[model samples]
Target chain A: MKYIIIASLSSLILQSYLTTILKIDTIFYPLFLIVNLIVLYKYFNKDNLKFIIYALTMGFISETISSNTIFLQPILFLLISFIVIYISNRIEVGNINLFLIVPFIITIYRILSYFILNNIVHISITNQLLYQSIYSSIVINILYAYTLNYIFKFISNKYKFSMYD
Target chain B: MKKIKVNPRYLILSILIIIVVILSFISYAIKSGRQLSPVESLIKDTVLTTQKILMAPVNFVSNSFKEYQEKQDVYKKYKELQKKESLFDLQEAKLKEQQTQIEKLNELLTLEKTLSDYTYQHAQTLNRNLNYWNNEISIDKGTSNGIEVDMAVITNQGLIGKVVSVSTFTSRVRLLTSSDIHNKVSVKIKTDKEDIYGILSSYDKENNVLIIEGISSNKIIEKDSVVVTTGMGSIFPSGVLVGKVESYELDNFGLAYIVKVTPTVDYDDITHVTVLKRLK
Candidate 1:
């Protein structure tokens, strides 16, 4: 529950500030995807179907409000979420390795979707946009993931909210 | 008898994947080259209203800081204008005579006072987002506020974009900077001799320039000439300033001119805008 709140709030703040205040071109790299992916990986369970749904809903709404394609982002987010959980379960990897791998996965998924689904041609897959996305997702979102993870871990330890159950 | 055991996690994941696929199909059906249905309108309105309420404080803080910085510059400009005020007063009568003569000529040409006389509604931007192909910015005014599709969106600087979709409380505008191939506008170039006409087509996003095509190479289009809407289509009124020509060159076949334009409106500073509701 605490993780869900933190994830959603961070998504909102990033949406509000990144494009308008920071003035960074986020057309290629969606920062919220990384946030949602981290949440799913941290708290994937049989009992947490509600969390999955909530995260997916937030991701959809953010993309709809921010981008042209309403349906595409949510579907991609869910697919990525499923893949991440499956991969992490199959292989025991450390947090740092997972963090490093997330950006490459996202960039490749975006490039494939841009070509196959969106039918956009004549655009290079490995352009500056790919580099920017890799930089943003790894450098910026890794810090975000750690900060939120630390805060949640602290709260769960102190409050005894029975949040996991 | 033996019972097969299954993990609930896999079951839930499969269900979620199915749901995502179903929702995507429905969304694609709803958006299949038609106007938004009532359900889509309701959803968009709710989201936009929530976003507007949430962004109020942020916008206030940002605008306050910007206004403070602009205050000093405003004062300096005011002092400078005051110095020139007396000299400009002498030219006012002569300018008025010239204006009346121009209006008379415009009346004869059936091109009634261009963009200056349109009824407009002021609206604040809610948010802006971009995708791989296009950029969309939402505004507070909507159908309830008399905003309709295809209305020209402009700021004090110049043309910003046109409203593409409208709900009850908010409207989504497609920015002129969008790189969509179909996002073209008929424009006229204001040269010293005569106005040359062309189509303002695709945007060069990397260089922040607009490409104006279909111009005949024989036409003497001067560099730095102002470009404005031709009002060929009822979507936008005539003479609304768009941009200035930066450079011009011949096409591959050397038959027509491809001119580059520097748009007047700064996309980064778009906060408040007005929707032009044509009088006619």
Candidate 2:
């Protein structure tokens, strides 16, 4: 719980200030996707009530600060996060499997947001929506091979808790 | 078939989902263009205030670095500026003359309002989460600064966007590039022969251009012709630069010309903006 709070708060700060400080264009990075996947990974096979509550919290923060729309962010995060966790649990989430799972979650979320924000509400998002999803997922998936892989290795070694291949 | 198992929890969940769906529509309808409730204001003000303070040190460091970079080419830049100074003086004088002439014409025509009549407040950009793409930016000035919804946001270069929502101390400016169907700017393209009018309908993010559609005329729009707001809808003040024409094409239905415009302001690196408030 503490780690999730720290991670999300830090990510929020990063999302707010990182571009200005570093002078980087945000078109290339999938900030939301990276954070969503991190939370989803942590929630997998955990306490269901806690997971659902966290999903709601994620939705609230997004809506209050960034999205400024009601229900949509929360609803999408709840549904998608639930499915991602359920699938990962059933599939025995592996580093190899993550390449498939992460992209699927991202694409679905983008498509749904396109329908809601663009079609239903007219808060239009353009083709760059899909473009960002594709490229960001690819970049993240590659980075996961090093960072997530190392973290899992470290955890299994120190805690005697193994991650299935 | 054996009795299909039914989860009582699923029944309760389905009811809750239906209730939430209905509530969403009700809340959304109530929230549009409405004053922020105290809770909403508190949340937004706190978050935006924190972001503003945090950004201060970051901006100071960034500006210092920029100043250092600028100092390196001071001699070369000084020579360039010296040569440009006389031309700029000439242009400034010409602009002032034109401004007075326009003001006299407005009086002669008995017009109530003109573009130059608006007052502007400088605002610093803060708490902008780029994850949503080029949709919106939060500015430091808000209702307290007399900023309101639909006010025009501009930089020194040109028009950037209009304010969509405002809180007590912070407001969000929806960029011209937003895919929102209602995000249209009435623009004018003046050429040698005539003033071509069109609506800037949408932004092409991939190419970094704005598409001005519904131009019924076939008169060739020259490349790099300046586009500016006509203020026909009164949402934006007239004569604010939108962009320059890059390319044009015939629509699929063979009805109108669709001209592509390259926006003058760089949306990527926007730090400060001026929000224009029309004077009564």
Candidate 3:
């Protein structure tokens, strides 16, 4: 519960900073997803499917708050969340590797989704705007995700967890 | 008589799956134009309110810092003026001459009288991101106020940028000097006879210069000419100051002059700006 609060607060701060300071139009889903994933990983049993659902929910909430896209973002997040959790479970590596992999996958997913929506559906994100957005997500999302991971770890250690279990 | 066993874990998992599916269906239904549950609207409103509250302190601190810096600069300039007071008479005459020249330039361009119909709401700059691709800043105003996307934003000196996105109480603006490839601006050069058309291209930060293309070769292009918006599109008015030409060179094919410009607005010191509401 404490980690969730911290993660949400940090997400708000980063969101404001990105919009106000960077002046770039961007979404902070990767940061939100990574934080929630860390919380689920530490508290819930690795084998439980609840972890997957929670990650998906976090992704959905994050993207919805950031932009105008409605149902598409949540559905896309569910699929990506499942893939990230599955891969992380299969690998016995340290937490850092999982952190790195999640954002990279999310970034790729966002770009591919953008292409499908704008090109196939004829939604029309100009080539220049699309490239700028992808570049921002790649650079900014990685740093924000890592920071959130560490902050979540700190919060988890400070408070006992019942929500995850 | 075979013994049958049921796994408790399997039962719990099945129930969880059912709940998730039901929730998903409800979410989809709401997204597809079904009326939002009262609870959903409440949640959305709460989140937006919290975001606005969170931004307030950040805006306060940033604005204070800017004020402090401005005060320091004024103090420094004051001290320098005191030291140079012995030559004040001579400097005053030169300053008056420069002021006259500025007035003459304004007259030559037939600059409109400053509009007084709109009252400005001051906003504090929360951040400045000046990377090669994304040049932008965020301010502490949004749709809840009178700010709308695509509104022209400018400082006292010249054009700053245009509003891009508006949250409930915060907005994002894309700066004119952003190096992002998408930042194309249509501009016009004020010549002795008539205004000439051009497009703003590359931005050189090191030298604080902007490159403009599309000027015709036959036009009598000269260094130090003023460039302003042509009002070709609905984006800006016809004569908002853009920059002055710093230098020009003939292109390789001699089709157009490669004109460099120095923007009139001091982007770094901008703290407050006005958003021009289009005349109805």
Candidate 4:
């Protein structure tokens, strides 16, 4: 419940800043995608699938408010969350090295999502900003995920928040 | 009473499915011109009002920065204008005489009857779409302010687009740059010989130009000739400036000549526009 509240608030702030302040959402899409996934990963439990659904629902609400498309982001977020969960289950528990592959995973997700939206909805997703978002997100999120993982680990250790350590 | 136990995964999946289905239906219905439900209207009003409040301070700071820059450049611009003041006066007088002559000719031809009288209502842009597919902007005026869908929107320079949807407090303007086939506008090309008519078709996203299609090949169109709305359709007023011709070419099918035009209004710099209401 606490993690859900914090993540929801963070989602709102990130969305507000993206739409209202920068006024350009696609330019920083990779960062948004990765950050949401990281939050879900940090707190997800297989038995309690409600956490994944809650995070996606929060993302859907934010994207619907801030973006032009109504159904694209939420569905895409749900799909990506399942992929991440499936991959993480196979990997060693609390393996930090898995973070290194996140950028590449995000890029693939971006392309697949773009393609799906373009073909299914007949939307024009050919903006150069889409490509820029993919490349920049990959480069930026690698560093971003590392920093976030460090902070989460430090906090977890100090507070003894979970059984990971 | 018997207690019912619900599985969490099944419950969450069902909820997700319900949300997506309801949202999709509402979105489609709204696009199809159904009146908004009271709840939807309230949500829209609250969100738009909040956006307006948050944007106010940011707009003030940016406007102040721009004002300072303008103040710094004013003296230099004034000095340059002083040199051309006499030349402009002479040209203005000549243009006034020509306008009188054109008006007299228009009266003779009874063309004034076809020209609609337009009342302009200025509106501020609240937000712009960040996607490539939908070239739209939300303005801070709506039905309460007398703005209606299909009303033409223009800047000081020329036409920007037309209103597509309206709420009680805000309206959406679909820009001319959108590649949708339904966005075509009937436009006339002003040339030395005579005016030629064509439909303003899809905008070229890569070249940043407007495409005027279905023009006859026999008409000799000069480069840089002006294009303006022909007013054939009831939606847009006639004689509104659209753009100037860039180049003419034979399309791949060779059915009709295609003329590329550069629009008059700078899409990048547009902040405010006037929604035109035709006086009956």
Candidate 5:
């Protein structure tokens, strides 16, 4: 419940309000996707599945509500969360190796989600898939690897999972 | 031997996934022109109301910064506007005279009112869509504010899009930049010779221009020709500005001309819009 409340409030602030004020929401990457992935990576565990599920859904509610159809973001985010959990179990966080691995996972996820939405709903030309994925990957590399963590930590302590250690 | 038992957490996760998948399909299948449920409208209105509160401080600071920037050159712009204002006054008089003349002529001919007869409602954009794939946006107007689905939405610059979904206190608009095949606009390109009509079909995202395809006329079209909604489909009101023609070329078999038009509205940064509701 605590995590869901925090996640919902921050999602509204970051995804809806701040991006509009800064005017970087367009011609740039989806910031919410990167943020959700990082949050899941930092705190993935077996104890509380509801936190992970609701965190992704509430954080991504802006997408689902604004879309003509619902549940695309939750469906995509849930599938990705499961895979991230599987990966998190085997990996050690002390090595900072996720800096290298997360972007790659995100890129594949981006392409797959874009493919699904394009085929199922957006229905534009198939040619834009490659271009959009490449563009998102570059933006994600810069944003996730460097700055968003600090900006996120400023907003809430939920990302305070491993900052001190 | 110990029994191989799956953790109940995984079981819960799997069940949740299956439920969401079923919901996704149901939503997608029946997504065509359905009214929002009471729960959906309640959630949407709550978010929109909060966004309005959050945007207040942001808008204030941004406006202050803008005011400071404009203050430096205020006098220069004031002089420039003074010169233009006199010219505009003359044109305003002519326009009003022509409008009254048009009203008299229409009354004589017993013709019904048209594109000019629309009533507009102002609404502020609460938030943009979370992804770039769909150029949909949520506005602060809905059925409670007399906004309906399929009503044409526009900014001061030109036509932006049409309302797609409406709840009690919030509505969603799908911008013209959306890549959906069904998102076509009938547009009229005014040239020196005559106005040519075509369907505004695809969007050229790379170049930031809209492609108006399916024009059957071979008549030569000039560059920078004005484009507006033809109002033929009845969804969009007539004469709403769409864009200006940038260039044109023949298709592979030369059957029709594909014209590229630059949209007037910056789809990236929309703050407010007006919904044109034709009075019944």
Candidate 6:
């Protein structure tokens, strides 16, 4: 639990640096959620309730940080995170292909969100910035997954298994 | 006989996830129907502020460098003036022509002040993207400094480009040389006084040149003729120096001319630009 908090804070700091210092556009929310899940998976013996809560929390925070509509973010996060945890639990953890599912889900959400926002709300996504953001997020996700797997392995080796590590 | 039971936890988790996803979609639909909240405006302001803070040092350094370059030019001019003094009266007359050019520039500055009421924020260019794909540059000012989208960006030499995106502290200016197919400029031939409309076709990589196509072949255009903005679509102010014609040749159609131009602003050494406040 302490490790997850530390990792979340570190992710925020890294995101701030990437955005301000490096002048690179990157989404830190997905990374924050992924880190928390990895920590939960390694420390605790896969409690579905806790996993659902974590996913929901992650979804809420990610949406909030991304400046998505407030009321919708928590609801969306809870839903997506729950689905991810359910599907993830059914699959073998060692399979790298399972990681691709996160970004795939995010892409679907983004596309759907775009349509919903445009058609219903009348909020348009300018083509240029949208393309740039999507491209940047994809690259960030790929890097995050690679680094996350190693971090999870290290935590699993170092810490004694507990209900809430 | 002991029977294996299904994990109720998995079923509950799956159900919860499905519920959340459904709610999220519903929320998205509802949020889309409503007007944007003040929170979004606040976030935009915060992001712009952050961008401005990051861009300050970069702008300062570029501006200082530009000042140094201008000083060097003045010193070079001084030396040339001294040399002309030692020559015959004819050389002195050439120096007077240079003086008249400066006076003419001063008059244009006065005219600029009278015609436009928009306040301009001056910025220095730190970096420019000259790649075949994107023609953009990082300027020293952003939204925090009142720079906004559709703002006309210009240098002392002529019109540079328009502001595309603004962060809090930094902004991206799309250059006239951008390879994006949608970039179109209404240009006028300074010599013939005729309109030549076209898109920025390509950049001459080997020669560091820009190509402007879709010109009428029948027009008596020549190399070294000046090109300025026509202010047709009102994207830019008229009379902003765009470039000078470098080359012109008939395309296969023989109906329009393929004109190549060298941009007036040394895009390679762009340091400062003035953002026009009120863009019509």
- Candidate 1 error regions (>4 Å): A2-6, A13-17, A26-30, A46-52, A67-70, A90-102, A116-140, A162-165, B1-34, B102-117, B130-134
Q: Model 5, DockQ value?
A: 0.35
Clashing pairs in 4: none
Q: What is the DockQ of candidate 3?
A: 0.15
Please name the candidate that would achieve the greatest DockQ relative to the true structure.
Answer: 5
**Candidate 2's error at B263, in angstroms?**
1.4
| Candidate 4 residue spans exceeding 4 A from truth | A1-70, A84-113, A124-165, B1-37, B91-116, B130-134, B265-270
Docking class of 6: incorrect
Q: Which stretches of candidate 6 lie over 4 Å from their true place?
A: A1-89, A92-95, A98-141, A152-165, B1-38, B47-144, B154-161, B164-184, B189-214, B220-280
Candidate 5 structure quality by residue, lDDT tens digits, B51-157: 77867887899889989999999999999999999899889999999999998999998988765568889998877764445477888888999998889999999
- iRMS, candidate 1, in Å: value is 4.9
Model 6, B58-132: lDDT tens per residue? 657966998998987997899888887777588678999997886698697865442233568998654433111
Looking at candidate 5 chain B, the ten consecutive residues that score lowest on lDDT are B26-35
- DockQ, prediction 6: 0.08
Judged by TM-score relative to the true structure, which candidate is superior, 4 or 6?
Answer: 4
Report the candidate with higher DockQ, 2 versus 5. 5
Measured against the true chain A, the candidates' chain A TM-scores are 0.72, 0.71, 0.68, 0.74, 0.64, 0.70
Ranking by DockQ: 5, 2, 1, 3, 4, 6
lDDT of 1 by residue, B108-218 (tens): 999955654678899987666644432567788989999988889999988888887787887878778765454688999999999999999877666778899999999
lDDT of 2 by residue, A43-103 (tens): 3345676676777777666666654665666777777767866775677555666666666
Chain B TM-score (model 3 vs. true structure): 0.59
Model 3 clashes, total count: 2
The fraction of reference A/B contacts recovered in model 2 reads 0.28
Off by over 4 Å in 5: A1-4, A24-30, A40-45, A93-95, A125-165, B1-33, B131-134
Clashing pairs in 5: none
The digit string of per-residue lDDT tens for model 6 on A35-132 reads 34533453446677776666666554444333334545455455555656665678744437635665665555555555544454444444554454
* Model 2, C-alpha of A68: deviation from truth (Å): 2.0
